[model samples]
Target: MKVKPWLSHLKPYPPGKTLEEILKESGSLTTIYKLNSNENPLGPSPKVIEALRKSLSEIHLYPEASYLTLRKALSEKWEVFPEEVILGNGSNEVIEFLFKAYLFEGDEIIVSEPSFLMYTKFAEIYGVNIKRVSLTGELCHDLEGILKALSPKTKMIFLDHPHNPTGQCLKRKDWEAFFQRLPKEVLVVMDEAYGEFIEDEEVPLGIEFIKKGYPVMVVRTFSKFYGLAGLRLGYGLGRKEIIQELEKVRQPFNVNLLAVKAGLSVLSDLEYQKKTRELVLTGRKFLTKALSELGFKVYPSEANFIMGDFGKRVDQIYEALLSAGIFVRPLKAYGFPTSLRITIGIEEANAKLIEVIKRTISG
Candidate 1:
């Protein structure tokens, strides 16, 4: 049997430890405060839960292939036309759609080094030539470095604003500058998975750039702020022409019935949206201050997670916390040997995490 040469060296995305798996490993703890995956600490929204229950009866029916209702809800919410929307199983699928529609083998794409592994993973799967530019010293996307690295063959740029792992955000002026110099043919893919949690007023959202007529595609998910990670509902917003091309490559019925219903319902649940946002924003501040007070270097974050450099004690503290039923993301895989990415939890959970770190470090 012949295998694609590009796939031979590829590794599957490493799975995060599930509660069951973690319990088995610990052999003791019953409660797990899961913060490793950046999921909403609140779990599914109450409105979403009710919507899903109502949607259960429709599971036997196939979802609408175009997902027009949800698309319209998103378009109204974002102020874009319905034709500018394309739904995906997850935001990750939208990334794949971009590859399927535009990128071909040997075409070039630029990504910040260690931004999101999935970008490079998809590049490798499709045999595209990936150019990874180094992030700035402040751990933000190096817009300058990216511009210098561009070539005629470049097709897209994938940047996770409120960058993953580090949780740093670049200013609005910087983004505006990038678009001014970027080539018209190259589309900028803003993977704003955590966009809802941004607290900084100076940072710009991808949607704003779209209104300004810049070449950009914004990928968003229900997973992060909406407490809908399990639903796998995500969408991309772009110009109608770009959306049409992406639609051509998208799988039929890519989003499920329940996700569509919940998505539509959640959009109308303005109170629930407000509650979730407040929870993330407040928790983000408390965690950052507490982590910093503990003598760790906490990076400024517009996202819900806090990235802290625990110095040489990182590995030791990570294992200790895991044993104590507290799970946080170790960043060694992302090349931060002395840091961890911690999702902001509810008040008690956040307090517990900080307390554990304080105790582990002091003794």
Candidate 2:
């Protein structure tokens, strides 16, 4: 009876089901392939595992309150000052920090319709009105539409580069044009959660805009390419003043000790980083080509996942694949009823998934 009016209608974000849940659902423990979430199929780097093992004994002590060491490591990696970086439990937390620091009820934010669902999720939580523009014909961010949606109430614009669900990125020139039209009052949050896997030369990385003095913040995650999803460590880069403000809203010891240690060890592991990028690129192309050859329309992707429209057989195919212990993300929630977003997994998983799809389609 005491719940706020806003609380009455809220629904939680639907995270993908756990591997254990899928195993239980299918009644099979072996031969399961998980490509539903865009996770690194190669698993965490050996260095991270060793680092986490070393930190286990010191679990009694709390993590460094300021997280300075992790910040310094990120600074060295991104060529930015430590003061310009703010760490998060995950990049998702950084997004939350932005809302806490800047949002008030009745304020508005702009977002692409099919980008990261978290943008709208958080907006609704904060009672911020969201103006969502649909993607253009090529499935890229419609910069013109975004510009048209802007207004005085617009407090921020959240963009997921190499957008989630679609995996298409806006190029530098397109971004520049959009920036030129945007008013200086609108702060931009560029979520580059999967930036490292991008192989496109024309796509502009978020850090470049931050360097240009735009009121923009670039968020990066160790989750995808670093294979540290379970560790929950990510960071944001912005103008020193903006980062300092975000830092003030951050809780002390937000990042756990083991994740901090793992972040430091893996951030500089050049060999593992190289192998991760290579695996995703090679695996993405292989899966895309294979899926296309199987008579599906595979959208071009620059990230670690590809989106394919499976036509009328989507729901049937999804259930059949689930029974076969292969899990891929269905996009019905993102408003694409006939599409599934498949992560670029290991070579064997990719090959086996294709085989399963062929068998399912044939039946």
Candidate 3:
């Protein structure tokens, strides 16, 4: 059997190495620290853990196909109707659904170059042409460039808010301007995976645009601040019609029962969410300050991670950190060879990282 032509040239997506794999690869488990993936250093919430334990015995059963309970809980939290919500194995699935439901062969999707790799990956997988617009000098979405690139064949515009690796955002006014010039049939997806960490009021939430009758979807994940990446639960909010369209592509029982129950528990755990937010904010400040003082170009961030350009010494620093069992992400895959994206860890992990970098640079 012959595979699709598009599948031949496409490279597989790279996942961050797991702790176990890191230990095996490095030959040492003792001193290892993982800041590579932007996962919560604090781990999952206690309430979620309790909920998961309660759900353990029910693993034999398939989850409710509609995931109604989780949707209802999210609806109450976001003040939207349950019909407007769609659950996914992760927000990534929701993204895939958009393409599956709306895109025909030869259709195009516009996305910021080096924003989220998955948009490009998904486009490639689904045999859609991707019109890549470069990020502005500030590393945020170039709304004007994207708007200019839109065509009748464009099905969607994928934007990652508080954008990945760069930690920059598109302001509300910029979006308003872009939307005014956008084609009415084109869908805009705001991937707000990092929304909980945003400190800027000027950046528009995707939900706000959707409520105002814009053809948009706000894709959110419990992975970041809710600390549930392992459970792989995420969702989208949009017009009820848009959600219904996605539902047609969704697999029955896509979201497992444990994740649904855990998500429900964590959605109401405001105190836990607050703690995770505050921790990331504080750690971001400390690390940004330290890195800037050391003369690295630390970009202004409103997320749980910081991106810094270390000039040509980035490779040396990265290797040194690896030797010391500290794993942070290098942005070579994102076409940023001299830059690093580091997840904000606990206070001790943050301090240890600073110490390691200091020694690496000085030595």
Candidate 4:
């Protein structure tokens, strides 16, 4: 009886500190900003609340095996055929579906260094090879480098647009250039978890590539904009053939009942979607300006969070923010020890974070 020999030293995914854990260390702060995880500061849409309540009676029954309704809803939203959509428990499950559907024991996947931890984590889990390329000095994906890194054994590449930790997105020209050189044999999976928050018109969505007949899969979630992170609702869009292959390995009822209800309800709640976009955009502008004025090098972000570089004072500033009932994400685990990832929280949270940072540095 033995585990895979490769798994002996594989590290487990590190989740952020929980509220209870934060409170214990901070000695009972009365109000916590809790911006670490990039969750929508707005709670679930009102429509989702009602739908979840209505779905309570169905808890005893199994969810629809094929989850056709939710799948159909997503397909219509993206203008893809029903068979081209795959409903996943979260976008993570769909990502794993790619691994399950395609890769062999020694196959490889190319990833940006420190982009998304799960990409490398899954590759390790399946004993797939990982080829990591560092992001450009400007902190955006090095698309050219990735094309050069591919091999006959390369099965996929994962790109997280409005990329993690730093929140830098590639321009349209760069994306097109990359795709032009990419070989059709390797699939490119765009992890657009933060896609909704994009404000720049020049930043293109992965669906644009899919429509052009590229071997691309676009993974998205209802978590951020719709405030359904707790529900674990997500989906993937690709050509029907790829979607069909992935579906074969996807477990029936993978998406829970309430999540389906919440997803459909949220998609219809245009007012809620409007409010969230305004909140993120307005807060993003406010934080970027404020953080920059305070001498932090705030990068351009199309996501709901911005990355700020604090130089040698990172730990001092992080602990100070924690004491003041604010919790921003530290990027040491993402390999940027001197930077912090601050979510574009509600107006009050955004303002309070600024006030605390000002006080911390001035003192």
Best-fitting candidate, measured by lDDT?
4
lDDT of 1 at 287: 89
lDDT of 3 by residue, 1-363 (tens): 999988898888888889888999788447777898889888888998988898899999998887888899889888999999999998999998988898888999999998889998888998899999998887878998998898889989999998998887778888998888888899999999999999889977888899888888999998888888988999999999989999999999899898898899988888898899889999999999999999999988888899999998999899988888889999999999999999999998889889989998999
For residue 309, model 2's alpha carbon misses the true position, in angstroms, by 0.2
Predicted candidate 4 versus true structure: per-residue lDDT over 212-235, tens digit per residue: 998899999987888998889889
TM-score per candidate, chains pooled: 0.98, 0.97, 0.97, 0.98
Clashes of 1: 0
Off by over 4 Å in 3: none
The residue-level lDDT of candidate 4 at 178 comes to 83
Candidates' RMSD to native? 1.1, 1.2, 1.2, 1.0
lDDT of 1 by residue, 82-132 (tens): 999999988999999999999999999999988888999999999999999
What does the lDDT read for residue 246 in candidate 2? 89
**TM value for model 3:** 0.97
Candidate 4's C-alpha runs over 4 A off are none
Give Cα-based local distance difference scores for all models: 0.89, 0.89, 0.90, 0.90
* Tens digit per residue, CA lDDT, model 2, 1-363: 597677678888888888878778877447887889898888899998888888899999999888888899889878999999999999999999999888999999999988898888888888899998999987888889989998999999999997998888878998998889899989999999999988889998999988888778999998999989888989999999888888889999999998899999998788999998999999989989988998999988888999999999899888877877789999998999999999888888888888888998887
lDDT of 1 at 267: 84
Once superposed on the true structure, which residue ranges of model 1 sit more than 4 Å away at CA? none
Q: How does model 4 fare in lDDT? A: 0.90
Model 2 residue 267 CA deviation in Å: 0.7
**Winner of 1 and 4 under lDDT:** 4
